[model samples]
Target: MGFNNWNSTHCRAEFNESMVKGIADTFVAQGLKDAGYTYVNIDDCWALPDRNASGDLVPDPARFPHGIKAVADYVHSKGLKFGLYSSAGTKTCDVQGFPGGLGHERQDAELWASWGVDYLKYDNCNNTGADAKQRYKAMGDALAAATRATGRPILYSICEWGSNQPWTWAQGVGNSWRTTGDISDNWSSMISIAHQNQSLAPYAGPGAWNDPDMLEVGNGGMTDTEYRTHFSLWSQMAAPLLIGSDLRTASPATLAILKNTEVIAVDQDPLGRQGTVVSDSGGLVVMSKPLADGGRSVTLTNETSSTRTVSTTVKDIGIGGASSYALKDLWSKATSTTTGAIGAPVPAHGTVMFRVTPGSPVPPPTGVNQLSDLPWTSAVGGWGPVERDRSNGEQAAGDGRPLTIGGVRYAKGLGTHAPSDIAYYLGGGCSALRVDVGVDDEAPNTGSVRFQIWRDGTLAADSGVRTAADPPVRLNADLKGATKLRLVVTDGGDGITYDHADWADARLACGSGPSAGTHELSDLAWESATNGWGPVEKDLSNAEQAAGDGTPLTINGTVYAKGLGTHAPSSVAYYLGGTCTSLTTRVGVDDEVTTKGSVDFQIWRDGTLAAESGTLTSADAAKALTADLTGALEVRLVVTDAGDGIDYDHADWAGPRLVCG
Candidate 1:
């Protein structure tokens, strides 16, 4: 049903040759035949000299003494499968390296298949693009052809490392897709991989699965309990069980941990549903996946160093059965027909897997809805920035508008601002905060902005700016009930402005005042008498100056505006940027000072032009003429005159700075 490519890695020439020989020898010594680990996939650095003059993969003649064919025969003799590694791009990950597959896809695949290869782990290292799907498809086609050419049904393993969740398209290309980065041999590394795969279960099915790199079950830096948990979780998650430890010289404890058949059965269940987390305790978690005949497999893992009792009930498995179920401790062979579930003392970074059959009489959970489904409550008072709100005199949130919260200004510029530097001057008693931002496909440097969160002037979290839609970061802090929050945009610098910028949302956790989300931008007004170029005008009468209502102009329930320098020198100007469907610019007649100037109106959308206005010259007549900003959502108008002496009337807007649709 499923395959385990878990093996001990052998890199150097001597080690590689010896390890291959040892794997063949240990097959029976380790009692692997009785267990189900039949595939011993060699990771990187097993071949010699990389390739021949014709670009064919030439195994290191000495290391692969008899070549790959001999290795394959030896493995097959032990009734085990063999796998090889290569890159979708030209260079393989090995330090000595092989020819990158970029231009020679057909030749590489043909060579591997000719070597009697049973599996191919094609990784995506140097290749990237929206056209990545097509590139992977091309390689997949080559592999298929290679299979035909060599008359082998070689299993295709796409090792794009989950860059695009290849699971969505992996079946069409290969059997498994590594859904995370290369895993290290430690508890933290293993737990991290297990945690990240919880949401990817829906994409796994028969013949297709999420790969957590490889198994580190028997590797050092973890205890027997942790390794047990590692094996149990991989089995329950239906993950491709590729082991990455030294299998030949494994300790009795390590071999025993790797060959647990009970865990293997749960992994190889025909249903192929990936496990979902049922309960979590710090680093400990319980995950369950459905089995074929109304049964479920569960893994209880303690990612911490100390042993802890972790438990999960039947209802948490997403099943409301008819009064009973069978609980079988896969590792201990302890069977119990109970009403609810099992509680096991999991060792640090270790796990326990069990098979639960519905209608077998398990213990009933006493507290209904006890599984903490509260959707990760904003960590008490840790609400981050949010969309704008305009209730009291306030207009919109900070998504677009500029605010000097606590003294630090998180404006649209690429400069470093430490979270601890935010002053207490910001109106809201905001001790904690968040910024609502999304990645724009148009901004290449979006990755350039790094936001660092601080608590009481100490760094809490530092995030490299990312534009992905989900996983909006909500950094938390120990404010100690303090009444101030700070944000330091480490990369907002000169020459960078995101136009569709809007305050998506902000919030605050427990304190004497209202919660953080309560004091939104809707509570304040942006009534500047002067355009920061002069004092407040209180009354709107002069044509030389203009001020806004501090209140944000909202569209689609968000406050979108140009931050910093509301008034500019006409020809050279910038506006807050983001995704906008349209933009409009309108100026009041009383806001224009016409001596002799030309105004240029432009709107940027999707990082390209959606609209623009020809220079509107007002040399003589002019009080002002509104641009009627109806269609442009993110708009900017610059008025300037080439002749130095000719004074042109100022062109500006007063009612709403800019509205985004």
Candidate 2:
């Protein structure tokens, strides 16, 4: 729905005849149409800056040769619906280009109706804060009155970004309205949006829905596990299923998530009821929705940085009528039955969504006990911000750590001394809590702090008074029968001067957690990502094929790694290990049927290309290569996108190895 170089770089959506046709072609081929994801909507920046002499919005001459009607016809020919974009203001969001339909709402609506447009995504931008409801209603009225035999009624979508709280008042004004800001291809953005939408649960239903922006499933910013959570949450919220990435070159994981029928069914449920949170703890949240078939869709989310096991009983999820339920894992497509409590092992930034049907209840599964990462989302209560970098009494805590751990601030009382209390949730499964308590090495230490674990206001363990230099006092506490955990800090001898505190590496220990992944690159830190190249994926089996021909990428006489795509001429970077002498991997495009996607692998050490490989194409000629990383602190691999974007571009580094010195 977004096109790059159109009017904005938003969504990286590039508008062109080939790209548009490519999306349309893949949407049908991928079977997204039958899944209730039929509409192919294009976002802003489609039209030129000025309309024709008759004041009619026209497609860019260079982008659309056959014009808008032809494009609409092409979409219709594929048995799919078409959508377009416009602005409520005088000029659209793209200030540099694209004329807005401010005074020409009726004319623009009539024109789109004539062109057989089935949907319209009206955005609010550059308006200098005009009346949102009135302007949007004007367009909505015009669309309703447009008389076009060829065009079906346009499903109006309002993109006000929740400025006027459209969910509260835009019931009949539009089919769906964005309830939040734009979403990026990352975990924090996705989680933030999900949290924001929790309040608007009552606003979405069958005829109308809450728009949380677009999907970033295939986007490379987050891992597959996180993407699955993103998709599942969006589905649970009944948000629009707009694909924002290139479908033609989607990864296997992305395709699997997009084609999830059980999840999609929840979104398309006839009941049209949005799932609401049944139980919410720090990082653990359980959401449930009553389905049309007397079933329930439950999503147990561990929205944290480390792995955790979130558990809840069937009664807790409000399925009292059913003694037990047949539970199906929507992401894994695995089935199992559960009775009293359903405890699932959820990875960091991951979710375990289950479709529950009435059945005989079964006992809890083994290894159900789980540990937890740091609390990141708002579900985790009792946390605030402290300027750790501020230097007065003690502000010197600097390994140059990111301001937030797992995107959460651990400091409190920046300028004036203010004692604050923060608490973390303790699931019954937790055995103990572990964290480092300290004062900002550089901030003023006018206040002494106390750290204690509390069980319903009863003190279990306490660290009497800790100062900046004596911070990180190790403390152990019994979490058994602990219903709540607290970190209550008090001001020292001075009256609220400067009491910056830190809780570093805060986590809970339970029975079991996620094992160290077998991914070869998980231990290293990701660096830069070019427009074409993304962070290196670990142990991806898809990267083992030749680009043009479907064959394995063999270096010399050995085959290594499974799915590291070196099929494109793109550069990727990673932090070097302490004792790693050399790094080895195989590079070649997967053996698919395509041309111009041949890639070249160039290893760079400290910004210089240290090793090189010739153009490896679908010719099935792949060389197992190794680079001497020696004393290099950082290593970068530059792979060309085959001088093409991602057309048949499948570059992989299967079984990458690190040789210890």
Candidate 3:
């Protein structure tokens, strides 16, 4: 951990020799040096705009009148390290166009080594279209040679802005690689950069790390809550915590956040394992980092504007078999214990971090259960958090509606976007899993997703490709003797646009089948029915005025074997008898009309309008509709013409299903 002047002073007039010396002195005065902050780095504009007659870099006369070596000597005299900035291109990033260390890599390295420089922030600017790896490696090799000649190691920081994925190749070339663009002193900028850097956990470790720009903790652009989140997330990600604010003017709150030794321990841990996302539904995120000890550092972040309860389980964080776990609040220094769950009410733009130590080992629980009712080992989503009994709306948690797939609503299931993986520790107790999977109807007809079930890393079941237009496809996997179960969703050869996928009615049969039952609406007897043009047909589309005259139920060119097909101004009522919990279906103008019809669909629960689909046309895709039927005696499905007359207003309720005890 250290401090950099770029974010605070950035080429300003105040970035002089005295400022550098003051920072080093303040590091000693402010207890920062004792707390592990050593380096005081100078960024761009430190050097003159031109090279000297001997092709050597010259310190700017006004900024560093006594020269760069003098500043380095002062920092070293305080028992602190010094860092300088240069670019891999012809000039630095500043508008002043200062000379860079591109062709003079060896010379610059040797020059900085002689001046007691211990770190180099190599930037990317004005490069002459050369390969990124080659350019960065040149300076890396030069720094290695400088260390050998001077017997002083220099930390190389590559600032390529992730335009080239340095994480794939920067190991052994630089100590850390910039994984994103420059970070502004704002919550949006910091959190967005954190999201970009969170997924590359595998590339970060002891010697090599992912640099998501510098810390903006005390920059005043965000609240203290947001600043804590910034610090906690950076430390959790094992990022180089280079303070970007001016220490001389830093607030006590900023110093407290920066000097939280418990948090610093997570960053400076010997194992250096970067935390990985355990779950991110909506904006409530949970990350877990394994420490050198058997314990873990967990971070629960609230990215929303409102305070929310963010939570996870010890088993989810890769620690289990403990009778109870000790949780040390890294910021508050408060200690608590839990059997397995770790959670807290986090503030807006805030984070709750903990150092968790597992208790004595014990046997895990085992029984037939819904996966949602049980804690998962880990979960990672593409767009939003992996939800329970809700669709992946790609927003904040619980912002999604009921889990509806191709019009079938599931009262119990997982709602996740594509490129998601959710795991559970079965402990060889589960025998099988039965689930209905599909791209959620929320995506309309635009999504294509693949569902997979893995047992102990072996692919047990796979749904080839389920699109938004397809009905729910059921998969039954024999997970007998397997210790782990993983539910995975992929982009199905297509991109992940609008890929809201669902694992509907997922039942884990450890000792028996699911607790509740489900039934298709078309298979149930209706209490009453009325049609505008013909008798309502079962498992078919409305073709003419006669019953059974319609073909298979079809909407937006996608066919379904089960659903109620009728004309506009029609009503179909089912006697739910207060047994069912919810009704889910996709409603649209039947493709039989071929872009020449418009109608409105509505769902009524005992005379109350529960859900509606405003004005759907043959040209539009099917719309997902859901209604709560809990404790209701009857449910109604109604369709009407769009006030333009019932011309070709053939409507279909596609893949309607009801969940009941």
Candidate 4:
């Protein structure tokens, strides 16, 4: 089950001018010959309606004058493979209710094999999740059976819409699988698909590659930088490079980039280690794949809509031991050697691919071999920041007052279960971070424990925590600049002990942020909860009462101030109660707390100053302060902290309920 180097597609129909003269086939032949990209595929719209009354597959007599057989022969004549498309269920992706291959899979496979079809891209549009694996295996087995029946070795390509991890089973059934949706001719769409493929690299192998739908290289809209990133990531992910563009009109620059053998060699490396994202920041990502000849292929991609510099060292990709290496730029055909590491300039949505050939021999493996070696600690009581210097630490909350873990106790409770802080690779140039915490069976109370991260005192991400204890709590963050990371656990409604927390094992994906022409935080859920001053049912189940915005209502204790999102002290003032008699909540941005952009604070009762714009302060009780003076004041706290030159930092709403004299 050895995998081939490249599986290319020429999506001529992707253009407005559906049909091409001889140029479509000619361009494909050239790509297959020059670029070493096999499988000159004909995408949708190549066939006409069903010709036979029995509803058999047929080719468009006008588009394919010599019929499907002739096209296959032409492709074979160019020393390239020929592929076709079909549906496993009812309709194809193009909305045509094509005959399903599920019922007549064998028959259809036989017909295609007889017609000299070398590969098949079986799609899943109208397909349901009725035993996805079984259905896919059925088609794959049918294809094999057809090959045996017709004496042809037609390769099967499964396209199940990425419902499940097809790579886990697709290799047994087909040659490759689609891990993402269809590709469009835009930078955002291309980078997005590429990033998704990066995470599933370990599942990709020779006969089973992750298909990021197809390529949009020669297509319009995307720039040269974007195309480079697209090609670089696809190559590193070990994905099938199926081109979805008008090859005839492709610019010379595009031709050169695609034809670069050095870059393509990285893609075709026999070692077949799928690239993984190392780190990400400000729309930039660092990815690396092991090469066959004891080297690595690194790609620095800037998925931001604007150009940015993505600096990274080889050490960031678990290659710190490599003292010296030669970096061969795939796009520029330039070479540079360094003793330390290297950084490259990345255009907006662009990438820089390099062949990192180590100069030294292999070293013995040391330390934890697997990613799960790092220890994870659960938030003991109400999750929040705990001031623990080391193993000899104090504990907070419940019977587990002095919560012990491996002979260590975290005073200040298990610092809020921040998802963003859980998964981060410090000193690495990666973006998205995830942290997992194993919860104990001795469930006390459960409430939403929202995790908030501050980088250099700026809010990074406000992640939501799950109530269930089956799976450990998860905190994820996408830090954009501001190196130092901080976690803030707003509130855990109940008192459940988190046993272990896993951190720093994730990376940021490309194009994950809201694109241009769209409002930031527009998709965030906003609601109002007032006049229902209800007693709080604190537990992991109702964690939102402890965390802000997890639910509609804000829980106010008799004399305690509930935690909310971290905010800068200078720009914000939490006004509790009504306008006239409300308490003021203030934040001071300075030294430890660097603020950025706008800040939002809510009293929960009145929608006063939900978000304010201006330079923020990070000063503690020093300069930023506000008092709650309204009658029946509940809880007031800061929510959002934007980082566009504004400081954001250690924020908490303080209140002590009045005692009746």
Candidate 5:
């Protein structure tokens, strides 16, 4: 996060005159302030080695030769705000040469105010286990008093990293509080921070926001796709948009991602509603945020490596009634209409962000079978304590549950020996439900655990019994008359012991009642991506994986798309269906790129040419590319060189895995 950039791309003493000037210029030149990225902050190591003779902090002359006031003035001239950083400890982090605001709270606040500092990122490091509330409150009060006297209202940000769980008491102490530690620029780090942020949803809003560190967009640590996911997650949760990279040297792709206006609107939404995880199955999670205009901001992310087909429905997002919403993809700006379900192929460590505008309501299809797009509702049965709070009435995880060795993440919440039920909001759409249930490694094997899914009051599905070593069991059963599902676990022939169970990858597949076109196939599986072999991508439309005409990519020969460059000869495979017979794809070189790469388009059915677009060049217009399924079990789209291998050739296969026959 980072205004200071932490240890990213810069060094401790790198905060200097040339650096601030360059950053200020970039802020204005890059339209950062105009795009709502208003604050330009310089973090730790900016101050002198120690306090001045008058007990006031000073910017290092060698670093900020003209002083911080000059820098603040320059930043102000850019029509943006200027921020500075310090700590609440005895000394700031890397204290060897930096001073902290231990006894200099008022002096520092007034100094910053006099210097026109509009923001303060007060950190907590090496502070020991001192009374955090009192320490932070002193800084907050000092800053407030400075504002009243100096006529400059500094936005106070508490970088406590949730050590004392600041969300519970930091409302009046800071404008935003760091809910997690410094975020490294990677998928796992981002996802882990996101998971913690999701649990703190109730603590975020306007003015008083939950800070998940800062943006790592231009850090070059993650792919642009993963960066999109990271950005979308932070915005959905109403976190502060602190730029942490060197904006002056940001790539065009990175800038495009950071300055996505539509997605930014979600973050700056006046309502300040924070989204939460509505569905998590097989590590594929869906986060839904309620926007101000009765619209919703939804992010579908894949945590597992390789590719995944992630799906969710309107009902899962808190929208009701059968309706087709105009789904606007924030990344690609592509819009589509779907009944209620949204099924798209998401690359590994990637995400699909959508701003769904409510469209015409209709009676959903009612005569086919498909997976339920609605999210599940969870409830725990019996016992509380240890992991549960009594006096505070808080939503604690295994807080008070007895004999609990440690907390385990279950369908409802984290706990073992749970008789918990995970109910799906099928909205009367699903006719059957299928789910895999298992006992996690946390199980102590103290007793047998019985897993069962009850449809209303009847037993719809059941996994007889399981021990610690047993893998997850699949429970497939009818759900037509079910009102709610109970994921009940019984302590077999013993008292409540270590009976940990999980409903892993639980799904409500359509069983005979969804209308035609209302349900898209959600049962398809995706293999991992291979560099030379390539991988099939899925989306309603993706400039990264689509022809310029906003159509599915045809992989016949070399072609050029927006994100993917011109290719050499390559082939990718996909599983259409058991009875698949025909394939339809919108294929051609994206009209945007000027490259005229030569490519041979051929579809191999069981290793033979099922269809061929003989020796094509980039001049050709986009058209329907089809391959006859005919007795073929495995199909591969072969993209080879027509003349030379591939130069600026990018071909995409969009839409679904394959349109079933």
Candidate 6:
């Protein structure tokens, strides 16, 4: 963990030698050094816009009157590391066009090392459209040579902005790679970057990280709750937590967030495992990072505008076989106990972090259940997140409609695109898995897919090839005594386009009977409803200001027939009677408005916000929204005008369903 000036000061006049020195001083005086934030890095504009007579970068005489080495020496005097920034191109990103290290990688590396620089935040601007890997690797090789020649180790950071999939090849090239564009001090920017970085967890570990840009904790654009979520997610992603705010003026709340030792420990854990998303339905997301000491750091993120009860199971986080677990809230410092279930009431745009330690060993759950109800060890979908109890709509999670194959809908199963792999921990308990597999009817006549069931390392069942014209084929896999179960779907000797696949009515017979199922929300009667333009329409989009003047619900080109559609500033309520366990749906601005509408979708359990869609426009694709309604008496679907005028704000709650007993 360290501090960088770009996000706060940027190329402003205050980014001078005295500011750098003051940062180092603040790090020592404010217990930041004790919290392990060492590096005091300066971003662009630290040097002159042009090179010197001998082709050497010259420090800006006005900004660093004493010289770059002097600032480095002062930082070292404080027992802190110093970092500098440059671009791989001919010029830095600033409008002043500062000279970069494009053809002078070796020269710049040696110069920075001579000045006692320990970290380099290489940028991506002015690259002249060269191959990303080649350009980045040139600097990587130069840094290695400089380290050997100068006998000084410098951490090389690749800032290519994921233009060329650097995570697949940046292992030895740099200590970290930027996985997304620069982040702003807002909830949408921070959370969207987190979402982009979370899927690449497998590419991150010790000595190599996925950089999602710098921290915006102390930035004034967002609330403290949102900043905590940002910090929690960054730590969980194993990202380099370079503080992006001005430390001299940082508030106590910001310092507390930056110095949370419990949270930092998860990032610095020797296991070096980046947290993986355990479940992300609606805006409630659960991430689990395996700790070095056999514990797990769990982050329950509420990305909506209201509070929610985000939850996950011990087995879901790759840990179980324990009767109980000790849960320590990393943020609140509260301790609790859980019998496999881990959850909390997280505030809107907040995260509840916990370090869970198993208390005693025990067997895993053995009840017969729908596979969608269980947690997968790993799930990679070709298009979007794997959907539960829906067809693979090839859009966002929960965007899929009911699990339909050959025009028949099944109430429970998994929805996946081609080239998907979902694995679950069976713990040698499941005796069999029965599922009807087929290419989803949504892609009928245009797609083909193959399905395979793997029991541990052995192939238990395989469907050669199934096309849309074919009916649902039942696959019974003998998973008796298997510790793991993997469901694989591949493109059927063709490209992946339109290859939506389904595992319909997937039931696993483990320790008991009675598998779970879901009911479509459109098929259920609503307790009450109101709309901005007209009555809420069932299984259709609100085309006109009338009850039945509607058409098939469509968002970003995908069509659905089973959902509620209404204008913005609308409310639709359903009575659950505390029987439903979850409600999953995809929400977006209905395509009836083309690209001219904006709206926000929210799920309210009783009176509290359970999930939210942030702000979505007609140009955006459908987004997943889920809520855990374990004991909810009533659930409400709400759509607002997104703080803008309500013109053309036709919102659709696409393919909403509730898992109830």
lDDT of each: 0.52, 0.64, 0.86, 0.51, 0.65, 0.86
Candidate 3 residue 64 Cα shift, in angstroms, is 1.2
**What is the alpha-carbon lDDT of model 5 when measured against the actual structure?**
0.65
Specify the poorest-scoring 10-residue window by lDDT in model 1.
374-383
lDDT value for candidate 3? 0.86
In candidate 3, what are the lDDT values of residues 193-236, reduced to their tens digit?
Answer: 99999987756778999999999999999999999999999999
Candidate 3: TM-score? 0.58
Q: What lDDT tens digits, residue by residue, belong to model 4 across residues 332-363? A: 77999987576788777778888787665332
RMSD each, Å: 19.5, 28.5, 15.1, 21.2, 23.7, 19.8
CA deviation > 4 Å runs, candidate 3: 363-661
User: Looking at model 2, how many pairs of residues clash?
Assistant: 59
Candidate 1 at residue 550, lDDT? 27
lDDT (10s digit) by residue, model 6, range 307-329 = 88999887666565456789999
Model 1 TM-score on a 0 to 1 scale: 0.53
Please report the candidate that would top TM-score against the real structure. Answer: 6
Model 3 residue-pair collision total: 4
Instruction: Show model 2 residue runs off by greater than 4 Å.
Output: 1-14, 147-151, 360-661
- What does candidate 2's lDDT look like per residue over 1-661, in tens digits? 2211222235243566667777788878877766666877777767888899999998876777888888888988988888898888878776564787677889999999989888888888766677898899999888988844344689899999999999867878888999998888888998999989865665577878898888888878889899889888888887787887777788878888888888999888897767767667888988776677656788999998899999887655544333456888887889988765777899988999998786632211112111122331111111122223221222212222332222244442221122544444444444455455555554444545555556557776777766655636645566654545655555443433345555554434333222233335424435553424333344432333333223444433445545354435456665442234677766666554344456667788644577877767666666677788774445677776545456655666656655544
Better of 2 and 4 by lDDT: 2
In model 6, what lDDT does residue 520 have? 86
lDDT of 5 by residue, 1-661 (tens): 2244553544456557777778778766777666787777888888777888998898888888899999999889977788898999888876364888867899889999999999998989867667889889999999999999989999999999988899878987889999998888877898899898886765566688888888888798899888888888888888887777877678998889888888899989886767767677888988777676657888998988989999998765656443467898898888898777876899988889999776633322332212223332323332221121111112333333222222333232223344343344444444554555565555566646777777766887767777766665667777664554555676554544555555543434332311223112222332212222233333312233433323433444434232222243656554432235666554544443455655666677544587776655667665456777643344566656676755655444433224444
